[model samples]
Target chain A: MNVKAMQKKWLELGVEVEETEYAKTGYDFSLTLPAEKVHALAEVMLADGFYLVFVTAVHALPAIEVVYQFALASSPRCRVMARTAVRADGTVPTISDIYQGANWHEREARDFYGVVFAGHPNLVPLILAEEDVDLKPLLKEEKNLKDISALRHLPAEAEPKEEKAPAAAKKEPAATDKKAAKPQASN
Target chain B: MNVDVIEDERQHQFVLNMGPQHPSTHGVLRVLLKMEGEYVLDPQPVLGYVHRCHEKIGEYKPARAFMPNTARMDYLGALIYNQGYAMLLERAAGIEVPRRAEYIRVITSELNRIQSHLLWYGAYLLDLGAFTPIMYAFDDREHILDTLEDICGSRLTYCYCRVGGVCKDIDDKFIERTRAFIERLRGRLPMYEKLVNGNIIVQKRMKSVGNYTPELCARYGVTGPLLRAAGVEYDLRKAEPYSVYSEFDFEVPTEQQGDAWAAFNVRYREIEQSLRIVEQALDKLPEGEVMEAKVPKKLRLPQGDYNCSVEAPRGELSYYLVSDGSDIPYRIKVRTPSYSNLSVVPEVCKGMMIADVVTSMGALDLVIPEIDR
Candidate 1:
């Protein structure tokens, strides 16, 4: 599914979806939702034949921002990035039940940033030792941390109205379009 | 061969630690195995023995300064990691690389990929109790390392690629040598086919072992040859084209058997496909400067999440870079493919024989540092 249809579907789940330029940003759909709807969105993505790309978190001003990326495994490739800001206690509901691949990613996020995946089964330290569970080494210092708004790449007013023009396009998608124009193997 | 023996009559399972030291486990990975006689009940991989916290290091330095660290994770496919990180920064900062530079990047990276696969082929065969193939595979790989070292000036971990483009340009001698190397590898392929792939014993060992379905790969997010072996024709180069890969015409090899043998064949055929890419890239090598002319000295990326996925030899290697409008990155997430690829082993090896577990894990072509990082 393209961004427009997915945006409508995500909106039905009561979240605002931002359609980003595939040319400018690596992802086509960007959305931020509450922690509860992550599993729902993951189910929809799994139904759409998308695979979990990676799940990571960043330490920002308000809270720890957890980001999940999914990409369509089939043709007419599209990437979707869904983010959720953790609550005061840095807890978000786990989607490991939906995507088994998310289990390790969730653990890695927990190991690095201390963002708890509330219901993750076997949520032990993945890339860290058991002794260093509270290390949270990737978290930024207070002076170095930036506000979430300052880290935003897409402004609300700067949404691409002209999608067809090549000047604003990034190299990868344009290259993919060129390849898609060619005759590919039926398999 | 130490196994836990319980005195209780009902207890049938024994625990076995596979590595963090064993030679076959490959590079400091430990798999805790629950076994009943020769059959494995559960194989849980315990990681982090080699964890260097590469992400934390990515935050402290300038974006360009962390180039060498990317090479260290997947040392075999180092250039591809460097390419991914460079492309992520280029896309984030809107830097344009010259056509010549892109061609050079593809050519060198493909050569690097072929060598990586060759090493995996040799090492995997060795793990499966064959020692002669490693000699042949390393003989071919040496030619690749020599050609690359002529330009990149390194044998293993090459930080040859820079942020905007590559650090050095390829000379005419390099092209001539690479063409000769391709021809030599093509000539040697038939001998390898006869000695390895055509051997009945090898086929018997791998055929129908470690069987998995396409659904299992999708559920676990497996990519590269393992996914292709299960009949998913998804290669990052072809599916999501990056660099000058669009210019090359090649096939994404697939096998429907979905077993260790099929995965082996898929990777073997990829060597031919990669040869086609390198030949095309060298033929289309353009004339110009190798590096971007106006790359800023201080590489400050526009604040946001920027990511690039490149087809590493093992699988899709992606770098998710987040900048805070400063020279230093806010957070850099290296999503190595082996992390996902290795996660599927427990499921695939659930009811498999203890001996066949070596074949199955070797077929995945894991680089442990890449997983631990």
Candidate 2:
């Protein structure tokens, strides 16, 4: 579809596309949306015969943003880009169902930026080991990271109602005591 | 209804892990093969052995300083990756490349691509149990490396490309050598065809094996030989026309079968096309300044994110750079093609024999560090 037609189609899908650009900078066109709406936007891209090239994130201080770049293999072959502002530890629904290529792309994004894909079947570390999932190598600046704890957004710890103090502090240590007691890999 | 979940499909009886230490030029990738006797039920790729955190490093360094580092990603086609980054920064900053450098870039990179395919033809055949062809392939490829090394000052990991243009200009000696080498390699193709293309053993191993339709390749974002073999003529150099690629004339070869043999044929034909491109580029190599003068030492991109893609040897190598209008880029994402191409293994390997897994893997022409990075 032409850019005007595509923009109209996106509007039809309830996507408020930011703008249409024919080869502006690196992307052909770009759309900015909230984190929850990325999956909806991706469906339009998939239906329009776009290929999911890569899913990545940029840690831009106040907000961490995820970028999904797509290329239309159909005639004209215009490139499309989508950017969404994700909260630290924000979850974007998986597109692996639509494009199997997104599975590893999402994993690499999560491994580097700690932005979770809510429904990825096996959301383990891809380039990083399971234990080093939290390090998030790409989050670091020259001297130190801009932020770490907030990188992988988790639910803000509930006010410890006395007895639940230590359990609320960590992800799964005290909660999954049975599995923690079993074993660990030799480092 | 979804793939990978396999609702009522049979479960795999055994799991086999092959290589983080593979002898192929495609670096440290471990494939977990779930097998039932001699057939592969599922093939899962486990990566991240050599993640250098190159993007993180990009954020810490100046844009110009990061040019050389791109070569480390796809070592086999370092020059191609180098051009993609250099041209990206140039486009962002509105820097113009001299016409002469544009011709030179096309010539050298095309040579690098031919050398890369030669290595793949040899290495892939080696994996499929043929050793004699590699000797001829490498012997021809050695001349390309030597020629590039003379002009660029490096062999494998070329840090030759700079922001506005390449680091050095080629003399007539370089031009004469490239033309001679092209003719020599052209003469070698028929012998390669006789030994491998027409051989019954190769046909037994390759024909109708590890097949992927054009639709399957497009679904998983596969490019280069894999896509061409599946009968799509979607070459970025032809479709999008970057650099001097438009000025030169060549064909985008395609095969209808979408099998391993088709992919092999695509790569072989591509070598001939690239040779034609180099000859045309050499014939049209212009005379002018090779570098854009007075380029700013400290580069600052206008605050925006842009993407650029090149037809690399393996597939489409794209660079997505997001700049915060600072000397250091905010993010530099390489959309390396192997990552997507290899992702299709699980989909394609669903019911193939165990040993055919090697044949399929060989056909993908994966370079592991590209995927891992």
What is the Å distance of residue A132 in model 1 from its true position? 1.0
Listed per model in order, the count of residue pairs whose N, CA or C atoms clash below 3 Å is 0, 4
Query: Compared to the true structure, candidate 2 yields what TM-score?
Result: 0.89
Residue-wise lDDT of candidate 2 within A1-187, one digit each (tens)? 6778888887776554554443447666666566667778777777777777788887643445677888876445688777665533456678777777888888887878777777888778888988896776676453442321222212235431223322112321122232222212222
* Residue pairs in collision within model 1: none
Per-residue lDDT of B1-373 in model 1, one digit per residue for the tens? 1133333467777999999897787899999988887778788999999899899999889998989999999999998998988888888888898999899999989999999999999999999889999999999999999999999999999999887789999998999999999999999999999999999989988988877677778778888899899988899898889888888999999999899999999999999999999999888789999899899899878667787888899887888888767889888999899999999877788877888888899999989999998
Q: Comparing only chain A of model 2 with the true chain A, what is the TM-score?
A: 0.69
- Fnat, model by model in order, equals 0.58, 0.50
lDDT of 1: 0.83
Model 2: CAPRI class: acceptable
Candidate achieving the largest TM-score: 1
DockQ, 0 to 1 scale, candidate 1: 0.48
